[model samples]
Target: MSAVAHAQGHAGQGSQALAPADPLPITGGTFKPTADSLKTYQTPAWFRDAKFGIWAHWGPQAVPRSGDWYARFMYVPGHPHYAHHLKHYGHPSERGYKDILPLWKAEKFDPEALMDLYVAAGAKYFVSMGVHHDNFDLWKSRHHRWNALAMGPRRDIVGAWRDAARRRGMRFGVSEHLGASHNWFYPSHQYDQFWPKMGADYDGADPQYADLYHPKHDEPFKGNPDTWYTTDPAFHKIWFNRIRDLVDSYEPDLLYSDGGLPFGEVGRSLVAHYYNSSIAKHGGVDVVYNCKALGSGEFYPEACVQDVERGVMSGINPLPWQTDTSNGDWFFTDGDTYKTAPDVIRMLADIVSKNGNLLLNVALYPEGNLPPESQTLLSELAHWMGTNAEAIHGTRPWAVYGEGPTETTAGAFKESAAYTAQDIRFTTKGDALYAITLGEPRGRVTIAALGRNAGHERRAVQSVRLLGVAEPLQFQQTDAALVIDLPARMPTRHASAFRIAFGA
Candidate 1:
């Protein structure tokens, strides 16, 4: 159906204020605000080959180091974060979130240094959080006055990230979680029922700051199913305008929405405008759009990239996809146990073998420097990537993902798994195949998938060499299995990679 028709069909579900508007007149290509037209869109080659990326999920919320959703969660009367806020920053009515904004100075923010570390850590792309559900824009947004330039830090956060990524020759991306802001921030407008001063109004209820706090919603969103996105047409239009400003200004290589394509027709129009704008700039589209809604069928086959949050696909996907995960919490939270380097390497190997990229979010502290643990993690990742990067970058999924005893649950928020030496993943480029061992094998390792006696016809295995190791692998390929002798000492502390060459 046409975009207008689709809008009409779903109009009853949302406010009547969201009637279809004229499509934005983009200069370059013939992209209409319709599902059929967007079906012609294709994934960029740059995105397919760039297997790993780094995301700075940094913002004012990191200031307290109280973890994700601190802005909204702090307002809930009995929540621990609320007590923390009360103890530290006074009551919500007096020194609420609006007062907390000035404290996020980002005094030590150095994008260039961070970008250099990310480059060494083998990130081909860098994504900056344009805004979070706190309703704070990190960029120099013309549409929203409550942005980085207008408030705390007094710097163009997105522009700085873009410049650094460009200097490092990495593709730039921006993630927008603003689509869910209206409902997410609804708690701010509420009065605490069980506080020291019962029923005292929070700063959000003040009409003077409604733009930043968002206009008050009558219904509370504590356990509401529709809290993810707002049905209010005014907020939808505001969302479109803000995101449109982001696209028109930054022209990032990738645009990621924290949720699905937002308010149907309006969202489609923004995406079409993004593609058309990219065509105007680069003469051909070198852009990618990612959203976290699976099986919606709202996205066409080649229209955009699919993103799994903190999870992986079960096997090789027909089209390229990405997994956006963080080392710890999405935002910086004090006393959180982070993923070890070995765990990260294992995840990367598994993700790459499944025709998917891993966009790792290295959580930055409010002061803008990495914690000691995070710094060490990056250093270890860089060391591992330094040796086995050839096996990852520009490689496609092999015939089989791998021969593994352990498999992660295939869905969002399922990043926890214990991988053994038996867990192996495969990727290929031309005649060379990469077999990555998730952990160090005790003795000789055997790959049953490459055996001549496999379920299907197997390729002839010619020779094998371990990446970063000077010595060649002692191996034999039989009809039963392909066995290789492992050395006494591991080349790296993390996952090991082997380049197995095949014969015609």
Candidate 2:
């Protein structure tokens, strides 16, 4: 079967067995705040004002030659990464993820310098990985002994990043991929189709790393073949406790979960704790939560934002949402290809135009520093943001978000055909309207959709100016459309924006 078919089959079986209830629960003090409620949730002014963010997907997984889906690779039989794991470390049973922690030497990590670079690259906020499914905390946690400071790195990773981000005048946040930890880690317990072929030493009989792998308990692994990890009640409690400690200790400006909200009631309690803690810290209400799963009817409706992965929504909503995507794989791999700077800039403009914030992009640094190619991309992005920032930051969707020939779907992880010259995305800042061209127009560009019928006249184009050019350009308005003359040569290589001043 194709990967898509496989995914669909997996989804069908999973949903058939378990019907997920309305994940959103109404907690006593947690009242749902709409966009209008004085207490109603409004996208935090800061998040709206600061349109772009960068995420650091660093963790113990970086220690190995394997990739981001280490949790999954441990189970897949005869896969290249699986084979690498067997040859290099033994089997999933022995030399498991916990044993890999000691090998993670983030020796070159410099949070201050990294945050400075991210800020220069035009990231308004920084998201540091708090804990991935590997169950290692990147912070100085009082709850979990298996943390960065206590183990491999021997430094408070999150705290350092937070301090650096704050010093650079950027909002700081943490990402918790621990929600599915219980299920994602299940494969470690059972002997998979490939497990039997492993040599005697490859069996998970090693006692030294038992704490890391969580020695098998009495519970029977469940119905889902796709769920690799076992969920022990005791381990679940520890998960919640560790996350609670993270929220309380850090009081992050934003909190991101890998999956939607946490798994069970334990997860809900953690969310409640995060909301309450934010209120307590900011003195009434201050922080924002970004969850994959959005809940309804809560005191802190505005307290959280929805995170869409690599996709833009069709229409604008009063509430703000974010798109989190990476330039390449989440973890740095030797042969990985990366998205170009233009691709990054275009994505940012497109996402912002569609009434969403782009947690724009990230590239993992295996050696604790950005590779030269990644650094070059960041520099180019900074230049792009510098020129077209007004069209991006602090802007909302205009009446209709521009006319375009190539339309992208409002679904998750959808890749679009390359946008053509006819495609233009629209955004507004104060009284100014920005029409960003996805591709360069050959002669003159005409926006016929802006006629009087659309409640705006062609005369509304008071003054037209190309973003990267110095002088204003000549333009004319007919009854149907506004047309602007172009320079003999385009100013920028890829996409460009035009600034239109209008009298409202």
Deviating ranges (above 4 Å) for candidate 2:
1-40, 192-211, 215-221, 224-236, 293-303, 456-459, 489-491
Predicted model with the maximum TM-score: 1
lDDT of 2: 0.67
TM-scores across all candidates?
A: 0.93, 0.85
C-alpha root-mean-square deviation, each candidate: 4.4, 5.0
lDDT of each: 0.83, 0.67
**Per-residue lDDT of model 2, residues 1-504, tens digit only:** 012211311111011112123333323344321222323544567888788999988887766645576755665566676677778877665566677777787888888888877887789999999988767789998877788899887899899999999988898889887655554444566565543654433233355545555555433344344332233456656666677778778878888875444444455456666555555556455666776532111123244587776667776655788888877767766677877787777777777777778885466565578877788878887777778787888898887776877767875566444777787888988778898877757778888666545564444667889888888888887667778888877666667788988765
lDDT of 1 at 324: 91
lDDT of 1 by residue, 160-202 (tens): 9999999889999999988767766877888979736798998
